[model samples]
Target: MGRRKPNETMRLLVATFIGIVLGFFLGVSFPTLSLTKLNLPSSLFPSIDLTYIEDKYSGLSTQALLNAWSSLQGKDGSAAEINEFNESRIWVPTNPRGAERLPPGIIASESDFYLRRLWGSPDEDLKMRPKYLVTFTVGYEQRKNIDAAIKKFSEDFTIVLFHYDGRTTEWDEYEWSKNAIHISAPKQTKWWYAKRFLHPDIVAAYDYIFIWDEDLGVEHFNAEKYLRLVKKHGLEISQPGLEPNNGLTWQMTKRREDSEVHKDTEEKPGWCSDPHLPPCAGFVEIMAPVFSRNAWRCVWHMIQNDLVHGWGLDFALRRCVEPAHEKIGVVDAQWIVHQSVPSLGNQVRPKALIALGLSFIDMVFTSLSFKSCQGKAESGKAPWEGVRERCRKEWRMFQERMSSAERAYYVSLGIDPPNSTTAR
Candidate 1:
């Protein structure tokens, strides 16, 4: 090629720069001025903003833009649309961690997805037809009680065992144990498992939830019949009436033959403030209470991680439902024996025992009292005075912890705890 005159070359360069500037201005003024915003097929310009292209394309994705581009060029729009949708599919990313917008904490964790796959499909017949759901927080020591509790439920119910005390595989030694889903983590309380796995929404398909202690004697408790009574009475939060002879059983839980369900019980003098309040009204011991699907959604959040024993939760259970004196109650016709034997309390290792500054007896009392016993400890302590003192101390600390947590949760929700009268 022959070299042009210097003046001509300079003039050509100036004209080219003006044209580039004009193109840039046009691109900014309109959405579809550039090839980058065309099909977006090559992914070479993935950063290109298709949303800025036109008013009609404002909400259309890059893939949608590609579909339009492909259609304009007489290509199949369906193929392009499929490719775009596939590109937007969300997946767990462990490696390029922040590469995608992750699911929030309230949603199921990524681990739950993978853990579910390993569990294979649920029982085919019970797939979505679980009439009831039962969760038992248990240890190897209460094997008998746990077995009895399972027998009360019909096969239509889905049974899940939350094994604490670190003996995860011990239950596998037995044949029947293999039938129920066993989720084990050392020292995790029943409420802990419930928080993570049994969120109310997760079990919405079930008609009722029986969150029970491992030691309930179901000699007279019929799961299906109890559910019938719950439905008939419209009881949202309830427990089977306790056999009056069951040692350590509260008077309110005692079964009365006259009625099918009862919401209030006579309390000891000076023990309760209102006749229509829990212990007196709307109360079910945490050990054997059953919750309907909708009610549990509220109660689940009320449970605190640190207060795994659920000590004060029974009193607060009324908060989840209205007319605490009416909606929550006890099914007198179907009662369970609160077997007081506490095996997990005495089953701790030497290492944990020394670290907690608890003697074997204290551990037994603490475990059964704190997070140890769900319904009632298998047996009451000798010298009820000693057990009473421990309970008083534990309960005091528990209330403090819950109060602090309540304040923090409210603050997170942008409310002043002291000023806000509503529960979190």
Candidate 2:
């Protein structure tokens, strides 16, 4: 090829430079072309207004809009708060970064979706503020503790009590403030039965619901601040009284071992400790958790599984919170005391052992029949067979660990190691 003239080359280079500058301007000026409203399925969620888009896009160039949208999608306070408000029909005029609307369907800044949903609609009247419904399952023995806790927190929140026996006579015997609602549950039901029996009315009557164990005590609990935080953060499930270092010990199968280890590793703080994980994984003891209306609805439906009963409440909660990708906040600002309860095996002794053995067998059978493993047998592998093997390994590990721990505890208690065959 012949060499181009110097003048010709210079002209071509200048033209290319101009084109690039123009392209950059155009890209920034018009990043997103049209705003379409998606009529989401009724089963998924209700329709949301595209009110805040114009505000977000008003003065933003294409590049700025792109950056702003990307930033708004993450878990930062602005994004979370805005998303929460949108769920509640509140409009935030700008994106989380305080950018004017560059897109439609965006929410306002400083909005709390949890509060919006709970309150349902805004009211001009202050006295008609939304109330809280607190529900729990209690036996006759734990009444005093429940009563004391309620009385202490009564001024802070509206209290609603649910008795497992479904009898109102006992509840009526004690005079309480006008704000408290006491309802009875049906007399003989499965163990994981509290939410379903009590939720419908609670959901209808209250802006938020708190589910708890009856044996819990509130010494330094701040119900107002907790409620305010829930409203501000737009959290679905908030656990205020969760013990920082406590959680259930699952029998880890091999498949679960990796996950367990990964979770445990994440719990460690660096040289400077992170407040998020203070020596625990899992969650607060299911002793007390505050649930927004949306959370209550989600959890109530998930808790309906027949396989879940008295002992599996925590497992059921994990499935609900994790799969939905919803936040389960544990508040450490306030504290509530839980009277430690015996383990399932110890609670009922020989009877509980038989029940636990049967439950374990049922869990194994259910895993085998699960739909995910339907065709795995053709490949000479069973889906849950791996889980079973893992469980066996976990059982052995747990036995060894527990034996050591028990021996140490017994020694501290000044008891001699038992020679009984079942003692291990």
Candidate 3:
């Protein structure tokens, strides 16, 4: 059987060689007259198909494009992955056949209450969007003062309350509160809430933003009149001038009895290095600062999330607006009295108020940090004192951060900052 097998293999090899020679001779004889062109049997020699490859890579096949897209999105290349990718990017364009039609680009960045409708004519849903937004970082203890301030604002203003005491439902007793937005976080400050909730994109619909403390008395202040003067003066960042005899701090922010508005004032000797700089000209306290939309966009980005007290932010307000002395000022015609009522500093819990028996020196050392008084018996140091100390620490930290950031930015540009020792 083995001998017969070897003889059969040899015979097959000879036949294959003869067939190949005959085919090569036939191809040489008639190069153009090939198997595909000839009327040959259908199954004798299957034709090589290039149609699929040509059609698939012609431009870009749908499946190939989808596979590339899935890879770009870091998804497994599968039919399910393609569907998920499309779902995830519903607002963006992907395919011409099933691409989503989008609204105006401006409308995408600007938002309002238009989407909150249950049922209404889409065109008539918002007859008028508020031009201004006023936000108060408040606790329930100051509800009366908050109500008074709310009354001073017209319907053209949108009211937002950041509840530090975790009290929100009680404010709803007022009719206006039902329409206002309420954000509650226990023992948090306005800057903390603003950094999280009042993002530039979230409040982009408003023309101006009023970030005020809860203790202000807005008795003489009229929102409409304030904005009118703000526009007239081209004030990109401002505040209702502090009543001269009230909780006034900076001379630049004190209201003048005779003027419609005041841009500059003579501060205490040595308080201001430049007449055009802060405390003398371009200054507004953080207590009741108003920011134009463009200015707030810049200011919002500048807010440090951890600097909850916002102690040094008043000094940095000038950074958000150009020609700071000219564009930042106090509106005297519409002024608010800083009530100076304690709100945040005294918000310690009953357990936290227990007096610590530590000595004066110990209290002094403990006062340098916010959490230093948590359990230590620091004699003569009140809970509010610890809070105040934290405020001071945060102020120093903010100043250092700004200086360091400025130095680093200058170094990145391969230049030294003005007045820097490195520059010399």
Candidate 4:
């Protein structure tokens, strides 16, 4: 309880001043120094590195660090993941508006094909953007059919062509082909072309997307009228009904003389598990399907990058729209004939051709000659056969992938997947 003398108080004040000066020098010399790293006992000394955790994850954004921390603690990272609508998730160091990454010019914009003039203002460059997008996966052999199909669509639609024959200049003979967007890749299927070229964001401005095969006969179809009828029925996914007599696989997609639109039909007994499912309802053949913007966005994501044939996609299209039986249907009033030309199917080399022992050049010439003559293989055992067999294999593969993916997703949520019998 006794008070200290002048000499003791002076010594204590000098020691405190020296300690403060030494601490400042140490901070400047080793900014990263931390009491935690030195194995110091926390009970003996006050914790000096308040930002140890922050410095450990210095380069990570706050959201990313939170996600990692949650994962380490056995928590669902999804809870800490960025929400789609959270504007603060964006980060731009130079932005005047905090968390706004995209500049005005770089903000979301729809893609278009209108040629802009170098001298004109961008506003005046395009009088109007096309409202619909029509794409055809074609071969030069089907030029006439494709020309006829393009004639059915009005100027309000943008024409895009995916040529599998490596022939673009030859299409210039058709007046509309000059204005059309042409992409050439030899021997690629329609779905392959679609997956690469028709990204949902790229075609977001269009109200509808028409992805059709070049073999379709559009003599009875009118694009504008078809769209009008589609909108009237609130159809988000549709296809012009195939002429009932030709190349019809599903009863749901077959043209009905009695109705303008058909969403459901009585298919063969066990083909569909539910009357509201595919081959009975909510179905459209991939050959000539049309999709609304929102539906296409979902469908685009559903498309498997490697599944070029799109065999099982017809059944899965129902998942993109609600009340599948209501929003998916066939426009019976606007019917098209599926010619089943098998142009791409003919790309397969027949066993007979291989057995002939002809040189590669000779085989090429012989194949071209055979294709010119209706492209049918002898005894149904060649070209088209191989293609058809491959399609069946792809269908099985696609179904397995979808089932596995669904099962994995359910497992991740700690839930058992429903039985196949009850899954429908």
The most accurate candidate by lDDT is: 4
Cα lDDT of model 2 by residue, 1-424, tens digit: 9999999999999999999999878877766654434544555644644444544444555765466566567557475675654454433454455542334454432211112224544563245434666655555555677677776554435565555545555665567633455555443222245444544433555667677666555766767776766666555665664333332222111012111111211332341132222123233334576766665666676443333232333333433454222244555555565544321111222223344454654453333222111112334644444434433454344345445665887899999865311111
Full-model lDDT, candidate 3: 0.73
Q: What is the TM-score of each candidate against the true structure?
A: 0.61, 0.41, 0.69, 0.70
Best by TM-score: 4
- Per-residue lDDT of 71-126 in model 1, one digit per residue for the tens? 55654657767677656645444424343344444344332111133465655333
Alpha-carbon local distance difference test for all models: 0.69, 0.47, 0.73, 0.76
Better of 2 and 4 by TM-score: 4
Error of 4 at 393 (Å): 1.9
lDDT per residue for candidate 3 within 1-424, as digits (tens), equals 4456888899999999999999767655653422334555656646644443343234444454545665767545678866765555334333232233343352354465323567877777776788889998887878888999899999888889888777899987899999898888777778888899888878888899999888888889999999999999999999988887775556788888899988899977877777887778778878788999899989888899888777777788888788999999999999888766645544443223237564543333333223211222246876556565667677778888888888899989999786421100
Give one digit per residue, the lDDT tens place, for model 4 in 249-340: 66788898988898999976777888887778888878789999999999999888877787778878988999999999999999999775
Q: What is the lDDT of residue 124 in candidate 1?
A: 38
Q: What is the C-alpha RMSD of each candidate to the true structure, in Å?
A: 11.0, 19.3, 14.7, 11.3
Q: How close is candidate 4 to the true structure, as a TM-score?
A: 0.70
Native-to-model Cα distance after best TM-score fit, residue 125 in candidate 3, in Å:
2.0
Which candidate, 2 or 3, would have the higher TM-score against the true structure?
Answer: 3
**Where is model 2 poorest over a 10-residue stretch in terms of lDDT?**
252-261
